[model samples]
Target: MKIAILVEGATERAFKKKLCEFLQSHLGQKMPRLHFITQDGPIPKERKLKKLVETLLDNNGYHAVIALTDVYTGKPDFKDANDAKEKMRIWVDNNPNFYPHTASHDFEAWLLPYWTTIQKLAKHNLSAPSGSGSPETVNHQKPPSYWIKEIFRTGKRGKDYNKVIDGMAILKNNDLMIAINACPELKAFVYRIISLCEEDKIIS
Candidate 1:
Protein backbone atom coordinates (compact mmCIF):
# COMPACT_ATOMS: atom_id res chain seq x y z
CA MET A 1 0.00 0.00 0.00
CA LYS A 2 1.04 3.59 -0.56
CA ILE A 3 0.34 6.53 1.77
CA ALA A 4 1.13 10.22 1.44
CA ILE A 5 1.57 12.33 4.54
CA LEU A 6 1.32 16.14 4.31
CA VAL A 7 3.03 17.57 7.37
CA GLU A 8 3.63 21.13 8.56
CA GLY A 9 7.40 20.99 8.74
CA ALA A 10 10.50 18.99 9.55
CA THR A 11 9.48 18.09 13.09
CA GLU A 12 6.29 16.48 11.88
CA ARG A 13 8.16 14.67 9.14
CA ALA A 14 10.44 13.11 11.75
CA PHE A 15 7.51 12.16 13.95
CA LYS A 16 5.59 10.50 11.12
CA LYS A 17 8.63 8.45 10.12
CA LYS A 18 8.75 6.98 13.63
CA LEU A 19 4.98 6.56 13.75
CA CYS A 20 4.93 4.59 10.50
CA GLU A 21 7.66 2.33 11.85
CA PHE A 22 5.71 1.72 15.03
CA LEU A 23 2.50 0.92 13.19
CA GLN A 24 4.17 -1.47 10.78
CA SER A 25 6.04 -3.34 13.52
CA HIS A 26 3.17 -3.55 15.98
CA LEU A 27 0.54 -4.50 13.41
CA GLY A 28 2.83 -7.00 11.68
CA GLN A 29 2.20 -5.55 8.25
CA LYS A 30 4.43 -4.54 5.39
CA MET A 31 5.17 -0.85 5.67
CA PRO A 32 3.37 1.31 3.16
CA ARG A 33 5.26 3.40 0.61
CA LEU A 34 5.34 6.72 2.44
CA HIS A 35 5.59 10.13 0.75
CA PHE A 36 6.35 13.34 2.57
CA ILE A 37 4.97 16.62 1.24
CA THR A 38 7.19 19.66 0.75
CA GLN A 39 6.63 23.46 0.59
CA ASP A 40 8.54 24.33 -2.52
CA GLY A 41 5.48 25.37 -4.49
CA PRO A 42 3.87 28.80 -4.69
CA ILE A 43 0.61 27.74 -3.09
CA PRO A 44 -0.69 29.81 -0.20
CA LYS A 45 -0.47 28.42 3.32
CA GLU A 46 -4.19 27.74 3.72
CA ARG A 47 -4.65 26.23 0.27
CA LYS A 48 -1.33 24.35 0.19
CA LEU A 49 -2.71 21.39 2.13
CA LYS A 50 -5.70 20.85 -0.13
CA LYS A 51 -3.53 21.19 -3.18
CA LEU A 52 -1.11 18.56 -1.87
CA VAL A 53 -3.90 16.12 -1.11
CA GLU A 54 -5.46 16.65 -4.51
CA THR A 55 -2.12 16.15 -6.18
CA LEU A 56 -1.38 12.99 -4.22
CA LEU A 57 -4.79 11.50 -4.93
CA ASP A 58 -4.40 12.36 -8.61
CA ASN A 59 -1.28 10.19 -8.78
CA ASN A 60 -3.52 7.09 -8.37
CA GLY A 61 -0.83 5.13 -6.55
CA TYR A 62 -1.48 6.12 -2.96
CA HIS A 63 -4.15 4.13 -1.14
CA ALA A 64 -4.50 6.74 1.57
CA VAL A 65 -3.52 10.38 2.24
CA ILE A 66 -3.20 11.89 5.69
CA ALA A 67 -2.55 15.55 6.51
CA LEU A 68 -1.02 16.48 9.87
CA THR A 69 -0.62 20.15 10.80
CA ASP A 70 -0.30 22.03 14.05
CA VAL A 71 -3.27 24.08 15.23
CA TYR A 72 -1.21 26.93 16.61
CA THR A 73 0.43 27.75 13.31
CA GLY A 74 -1.85 30.78 12.94
CA LYS A 75 -4.28 29.85 10.25
CA PRO A 76 -6.63 32.83 10.43
CA ASP A 77 -9.75 30.91 9.47
CA PHE A 78 -9.50 28.44 12.32
CA LYS A 79 -10.61 29.56 15.77
CA ASP A 80 -9.26 26.45 17.46
CA ALA A 81 -8.16 22.88 16.87
CA ASN A 82 -11.70 21.59 16.33
CA ASP A 83 -12.38 24.39 13.89
CA ALA A 84 -9.25 23.58 11.93
CA LYS A 85 -10.05 19.86 11.79
CA GLU A 86 -13.67 20.52 10.89
CA LYS A 87 -12.61 22.78 8.07
CA MET A 88 -10.27 20.15 6.75
CA ARG A 89 -12.95 17.47 7.09
CA ILE A 90 -15.33 19.56 5.02
CA TRP A 91 -12.64 20.23 2.49
CA VAL A 92 -11.94 16.51 2.30
CA ASP A 93 -15.68 16.03 1.61
CA ASN A 94 -16.12 12.65 3.26
CA ASN A 95 -13.45 11.01 1.14
CA PRO A 96 -12.57 7.68 2.76
CA ASN A 97 -9.09 7.71 1.27
CA PHE A 98 -8.22 11.05 2.87
CA TYR A 99 -7.89 11.71 6.59
CA PRO A 100 -7.04 14.94 8.44
CA HIS A 101 -5.44 15.05 11.87
CA THR A 102 -4.46 18.20 13.76
CA ALA A 103 -2.03 18.35 16.63
CA SER A 104 -3.51 20.77 19.14
CA HIS A 105 -1.32 23.84 19.78
CA ASP A 106 1.67 21.92 18.43
CA PHE A 107 2.95 18.39 17.86
CA GLU A 108 5.12 18.56 20.97
CA ALA A 109 2.03 18.54 23.17
CA TRP A 110 1.83 14.83 22.44
CA LEU A 111 5.08 14.37 24.34
CA LEU A 112 4.05 16.19 27.53
CA PRO A 113 2.18 13.25 29.00
CA TYR A 114 5.17 10.97 28.52
CA TRP A 115 7.72 12.88 30.56
CA THR A 116 8.71 9.82 32.54
CA THR A 117 9.10 7.80 29.39
CA ILE A 118 11.27 10.52 27.88
CA GLN A 119 13.35 10.79 31.03
CA LYS A 120 13.94 7.08 31.02
CA LEU A 121 14.77 6.98 27.34
CA ALA A 122 17.24 9.87 27.49
CA LYS A 123 18.65 8.75 30.83
CA HIS A 124 18.45 12.33 32.05
CA ASN A 125 16.40 14.26 34.55
CA LEU A 126 13.63 16.29 32.91
CA SER A 127 13.23 19.81 34.23
CA ALA A 128 9.58 20.17 33.35
CA PRO A 129 7.08 18.70 35.77
CA SER A 130 4.51 16.20 34.54
CA GLY A 131 1.50 18.02 33.16
CA SER A 132 -2.17 17.48 34.06
CA GLY A 133 -5.60 17.92 32.42
CA SER A 134 -6.54 17.12 28.85
CA PRO A 135 -3.63 17.05 26.41
CA GLU A 136 -4.59 20.38 24.84
CA THR A 137 -5.40 22.02 28.14
CA VAL A 138 -2.20 21.06 29.87
CA ASN A 139 0.43 22.56 27.59
CA HIS A 140 -1.25 25.22 25.55
CA GLN A 141 0.87 28.03 26.93
CA LYS A 142 4.10 27.13 25.05
CA PRO A 143 5.07 24.94 22.19
CA PRO A 144 6.12 21.35 23.05
CA SER A 145 9.43 22.02 21.32
CA TYR A 146 10.21 24.71 23.84
CA TRP A 147 9.48 22.49 26.79
CA ILE A 148 11.52 19.65 25.36
CA LYS A 149 14.49 21.93 24.79
CA GLU A 150 14.23 23.21 28.34
CA ILE A 151 14.12 19.66 29.70
CA PHE A 152 17.31 18.71 27.91
CA ARG A 153 19.08 21.98 28.65
CA THR A 154 18.52 21.64 32.40
CA GLY A 155 19.45 17.97 32.56
CA LYS A 156 22.63 16.66 34.15
CA ARG A 157 24.57 16.75 30.89
CA GLY A 158 22.85 19.97 29.73
CA LYS A 159 22.40 18.74 26.20
CA ASP A 160 20.41 20.58 23.55
CA TYR A 161 17.32 18.86 22.13
CA ASN A 162 17.40 18.54 18.40
CA LYS A 163 13.92 18.14 17.03
CA VAL A 164 14.88 15.82 14.23
CA ILE A 165 17.39 13.80 16.27
CA ASP A 166 16.36 13.74 19.94
CA GLY A 167 12.65 14.12 19.20
CA MET A 168 12.61 11.12 16.90
CA ALA A 169 14.76 9.16 19.33
CA ILE A 170 12.37 9.81 22.21
CA LEU A 171 9.39 8.87 20.11
CA LYS A 172 10.99 5.66 18.86
CA ASN A 173 12.20 4.49 22.26
CA ASN A 174 9.12 5.39 24.33
CA ASP A 175 6.10 3.19 24.99
CA LEU A 176 3.68 3.56 22.09
CA MET A 177 0.73 2.23 24.04
CA ILE A 178 1.26 4.74 26.82
CA ALA A 179 1.42 7.65 24.34
CA ILE A 180 -1.71 6.45 22.52
CA ASN A 181 -3.63 6.25 25.79
CA ALA A 182 -2.49 9.63 27.03
CA CYS A 183 -3.08 11.73 23.90
CA PRO A 184 -6.58 11.70 22.43
CA GLU A 185 -5.60 13.37 19.16
CA LEU A 186 -2.81 10.86 18.63
CA LYS A 187 -5.14 7.99 19.49
CA ALA A 188 -7.63 9.15 16.90
CA PHE A 189 -4.96 9.39 14.21
CA VAL A 190 -3.50 5.97 15.05
CA TYR A 191 -6.95 4.41 15.14
CA ARG A 192 -7.66 5.77 11.69
CA ILE A 193 -4.39 4.40 10.35
CA ILE A 194 -5.08 0.99 11.90
CA SER A 195 -8.57 0.96 10.42
CA LEU A 196 -7.20 1.84 7.01
CA CYS A 197 -4.68 -0.99 7.24
CA GLU A 198 -7.43 -3.42 8.18
CA GLU A 199 -9.66 -2.22 5.38
CA ASP A 200 -6.87 -2.63 2.88
CA LYS A 201 -6.23 -6.21 4.11
CA ILE A 202 -2.76 -5.13 5.16
CA ILE A 203 -3.50 -6.19 8.72
CA SER A 204 -6.16 -8.37 10.25
Candidate 2:
Protein backbone atom coordinates (compact mmCIF):
# COMPACT_ATOMS: atom_id res chain seq x y z
CA MET A 1 0.00 0.00 0.00
CA LYS A 2 2.67 2.44 -1.05
CA ILE A 3 1.43 5.96 -1.87
CA ALA A 4 3.02 9.15 -3.18
CA ILE A 5 2.02 12.65 -2.00
CA LEU A 6 2.92 15.56 -4.25
CA VAL A 7 3.29 18.79 -2.29
CA GLU A 8 4.57 22.32 -2.82
CA GLY A 9 7.91 22.41 -1.03
CA ALA A 10 10.17 21.53 1.88
CA THR A 11 7.78 22.70 4.60
CA GLU A 12 5.45 19.79 3.92
CA ARG A 13 8.38 17.42 3.60
CA ALA A 14 9.34 18.32 7.16
CA PHE A 15 6.16 16.55 8.14
CA LYS A 16 7.74 13.15 7.51
CA LYS A 17 8.63 12.15 11.06
CA LYS A 18 5.55 13.39 12.90
CA LEU A 19 3.19 12.17 10.20
CA CYS A 20 4.71 8.73 10.29
CA GLU A 21 4.45 8.63 14.06
CA PHE A 22 0.75 9.44 13.86
CA LEU A 23 0.07 6.89 11.12
CA GLN A 24 1.88 4.12 12.91
CA SER A 25 -0.22 4.52 16.04
CA HIS A 26 -3.42 4.04 14.06
CA LEU A 27 -2.45 1.85 11.10
CA GLY A 28 0.18 -0.10 12.98
CA GLN A 29 1.68 -2.76 10.69
CA LYS A 30 -0.70 -1.66 7.95
CA MET A 31 0.98 1.74 7.64
CA PRO A 32 2.06 2.29 4.09
CA ARG A 33 5.14 3.92 2.61
CA LEU A 34 4.06 7.49 1.83
CA HIS A 35 6.34 9.23 -0.63
CA PHE A 36 6.10 13.01 -0.56
CA ILE A 37 7.33 14.64 -3.76
CA THR A 38 7.78 18.40 -3.93
CA GLN A 39 7.09 20.70 -6.88
CA ASP A 40 9.49 23.41 -5.60
CA GLY A 41 6.19 25.29 -5.83
CA PRO A 42 2.54 24.29 -6.00
CA ILE A 43 1.71 20.91 -7.53
CA PRO A 44 2.31 21.27 -11.26
CA LYS A 45 -0.43 22.89 -13.28
CA GLU A 46 -2.91 20.87 -15.38
CA ARG A 47 -1.22 18.81 -18.09
CA LYS A 48 2.07 18.83 -16.26
CA LEU A 49 0.30 17.35 -13.24
CA LYS A 50 -1.32 14.73 -15.43
CA LYS A 51 2.03 13.84 -16.86
CA LEU A 52 3.61 13.51 -13.45
CA VAL A 53 0.84 11.29 -12.12
CA GLU A 54 1.14 9.06 -15.16
CA THR A 55 4.85 8.73 -14.68
CA LEU A 56 4.47 7.75 -11.02
CA LEU A 57 1.89 5.11 -11.86
CA ASP A 58 3.46 3.71 -15.01
CA ASN A 59 7.17 4.12 -14.34
CA ASN A 60 7.46 4.28 -10.57
CA GLY A 61 6.27 1.40 -8.37
CA TYR A 62 3.80 3.52 -6.44
CA HIS A 63 0.27 2.20 -6.01
CA ALA A 64 -1.33 5.62 -5.87
CA VAL A 65 -0.31 9.26 -6.21
CA ILE A 66 -1.90 11.98 -4.07
CA ALA A 67 -1.47 15.70 -4.59
CA LEU A 68 -1.86 18.26 -1.78
CA THR A 69 -1.71 21.93 -2.58
CA ASP A 70 -2.35 25.12 -0.61
CA VAL A 71 -5.39 27.12 -1.62
CA TYR A 72 -3.61 30.27 -0.45
CA THR A 73 -0.52 29.98 -2.56
CA GLY A 74 1.03 33.41 -3.25
CA LYS A 75 -0.92 33.49 -6.50
CA PRO A 76 -4.67 33.03 -6.75
CA ASP A 77 -4.51 29.73 -8.57
CA PHE A 78 -7.44 28.50 -6.46
CA LYS A 79 -10.16 30.45 -4.73
CA ASP A 80 -10.66 28.05 -1.88
CA ALA A 81 -10.26 24.43 -0.86
CA ASN A 82 -13.16 23.15 -2.93
CA ASP A 83 -12.07 25.18 -5.92
CA ALA A 84 -8.51 24.03 -5.58
CA LYS A 85 -9.50 20.36 -5.38
CA GLU A 86 -12.05 20.67 -8.15
CA LYS A 87 -9.47 22.21 -10.44
CA MET A 88 -6.98 19.48 -9.67
CA ARG A 89 -9.56 16.79 -10.27
CA ILE A 90 -10.47 18.35 -13.58
CA TRP A 91 -6.81 18.70 -14.43
CA VAL A 92 -6.11 15.13 -13.47
CA ASP A 93 -9.23 14.09 -15.40
CA ASN A 94 -10.58 12.03 -12.48
CA ASN A 95 -7.97 9.31 -12.67
CA PRO A 96 -9.01 6.65 -10.12
CA ASN A 97 -5.54 6.22 -8.64
CA PHE A 98 -4.93 9.94 -8.29
CA TYR A 99 -6.20 11.83 -5.22
CA PRO A 100 -6.26 15.60 -4.77
CA HIS A 101 -6.22 17.17 -1.32
CA THR A 102 -5.60 20.68 -0.03
CA ALA A 103 -4.80 22.70 3.00
CA SER A 104 -7.61 25.27 3.10
CA HIS A 105 -5.37 28.32 3.03
CA ASP A 106 -1.89 26.84 3.27
CA PHE A 107 0.32 24.38 5.15
CA GLU A 108 0.27 26.61 8.23
CA ALA A 109 -3.44 26.06 8.61
CA TRP A 110 -2.62 22.56 9.72
CA LEU A 111 -0.17 23.93 12.28
CA LEU A 112 -2.76 26.24 13.81
CA PRO A 113 -4.28 23.26 15.58
CA TYR A 114 -1.21 23.10 17.77
CA TRP A 115 -1.15 26.67 18.98
CA THR A 116 -0.34 25.78 22.54
CA THR A 117 2.63 23.77 21.40
CA ILE A 118 3.60 26.54 19.04
CA GLN A 119 3.56 29.14 21.79
CA LYS A 120 5.65 26.87 23.94
CA LEU A 121 8.14 26.18 21.22
CA ALA A 122 8.21 29.77 20.12
CA LYS A 123 8.29 31.07 23.71
CA HIS A 124 5.37 33.24 22.85
CA ASN A 125 1.96 33.73 24.38
CA LEU A 126 0.06 34.91 21.36
CA SER A 127 -3.61 34.08 21.44
CA ALA A 128 -5.13 31.97 18.73
CA PRO A 129 -6.84 33.80 15.88
CA SER A 130 -10.14 35.30 16.98
CA GLY A 131 -12.67 33.45 14.88
CA SER A 132 -13.58 30.20 16.60
CA GLY A 133 -9.90 29.29 16.78
CA SER A 134 -10.71 26.98 13.88
CA PRO A 135 -7.64 26.65 11.75
CA GLU A 136 -9.43 26.61 8.41
CA THR A 137 -11.17 29.93 9.07
CA VAL A 138 -7.83 31.70 9.03
CA ASN A 139 -8.37 33.23 5.62
CA HIS A 140 -6.21 33.73 2.59
CA GLN A 141 -5.97 37.46 3.20
CA LYS A 142 -4.09 37.18 6.51
CA PRO A 143 -3.50 33.43 6.22
CA PRO A 144 -2.36 31.10 8.96
CA SER A 145 1.24 31.33 7.94
CA TYR A 146 1.23 35.06 8.44
CA TRP A 147 -0.20 34.75 11.96
CA ILE A 148 2.30 32.06 12.82
CA LYS A 149 5.18 33.98 11.36
CA GLU A 150 4.07 37.09 13.19
CA ILE A 151 3.88 35.26 16.49
CA PHE A 152 7.35 33.91 16.08
CA ARG A 153 8.65 37.24 14.97
CA THR A 154 7.31 39.31 17.87
CA GLY A 155 7.66 36.67 20.51
CA LYS A 156 10.39 36.54 23.09
CA ARG A 157 12.47 34.62 20.61
CA GLY A 158 12.30 37.52 18.16
CA LYS A 159 12.50 35.11 15.30
CA ASP A 160 10.51 34.25 12.21
CA TYR A 161 8.57 31.09 11.56
CA ASN A 162 10.92 28.79 9.74
CA LYS A 163 8.42 26.78 7.80
CA VAL A 164 10.92 23.98 7.38
CA ILE A 165 11.73 23.70 11.09
CA ASP A 166 8.98 25.32 13.16
CA GLY A 167 6.23 23.37 11.41
CA MET A 168 7.65 20.01 12.44
CA ALA A 169 8.30 21.27 15.96
CA ILE A 170 4.65 22.26 16.34
CA LEU A 171 3.50 18.87 15.09
CA LYS A 172 5.88 16.73 17.12
CA ASN A 173 4.29 14.60 19.86
CA ASN A 174 0.93 16.08 18.99
CA ASP A 175 -2.06 14.00 17.96
CA LEU A 176 -2.87 14.15 14.26
CA MET A 177 -6.46 13.26 15.12
CA ILE A 178 -6.89 16.67 16.71
CA ALA A 179 -6.12 18.42 13.46
CA ILE A 180 -8.15 15.87 11.50
CA ASN A 181 -11.17 16.75 13.59
CA ALA A 182 -10.55 20.46 13.10
CA CYS A 183 -9.72 20.56 9.40
CA PRO A 184 -11.88 18.84 6.81
CA GLU A 185 -9.13 18.77 4.22
CA LEU A 186 -6.85 17.00 6.66
CA LYS A 187 -9.62 14.51 7.39
CA ALA A 188 -10.00 13.85 3.69
CA PHE A 189 -6.29 13.38 3.29
CA VAL A 190 -6.20 10.88 6.14
CA TYR A 191 -9.32 9.14 4.90
CA ARG A 192 -7.78 8.43 1.52
CA ILE A 193 -4.63 7.06 3.04
CA ILE A 194 -6.48 4.95 5.63
CA SER A 195 -8.91 3.66 3.03
CA LEU A 196 -6.09 2.68 0.70
CA CYS A 197 -4.41 0.85 3.55
CA GLU A 198 -7.68 -1.04 4.19
CA GLU A 199 -7.98 -0.02 7.82
CA ASP A 200 -11.13 0.67 9.79
CA LYS A 201 -11.91 4.36 9.61
CA ILE A 202 -11.00 5.72 13.00
CA ILE A 203 -11.40 9.27 11.79
CA SER A 204 -15.17 9.04 11.55
Which structure among the candidates has the greatest TM-score?
2
Q: How would you encode candidate 2's per-residue C-alpha lDDT over 25-141 as one tens digit per residue? A: 778889999998988987898999999998999899899999999888899798788898889888978999999999888888888888899888778898988752678888877
Off by over 4 Å in 1: 38-46, 74-77, 92-96, 120-133, 200-204
TM-score of each: 0.79, 0.94
lDDT of each: 0.67, 0.86
Off by over 4 Å in 2: none
Which residue pairs of candidate 1 clash? none
In model 1, the Cα lDDT at residue 174 comes to 71
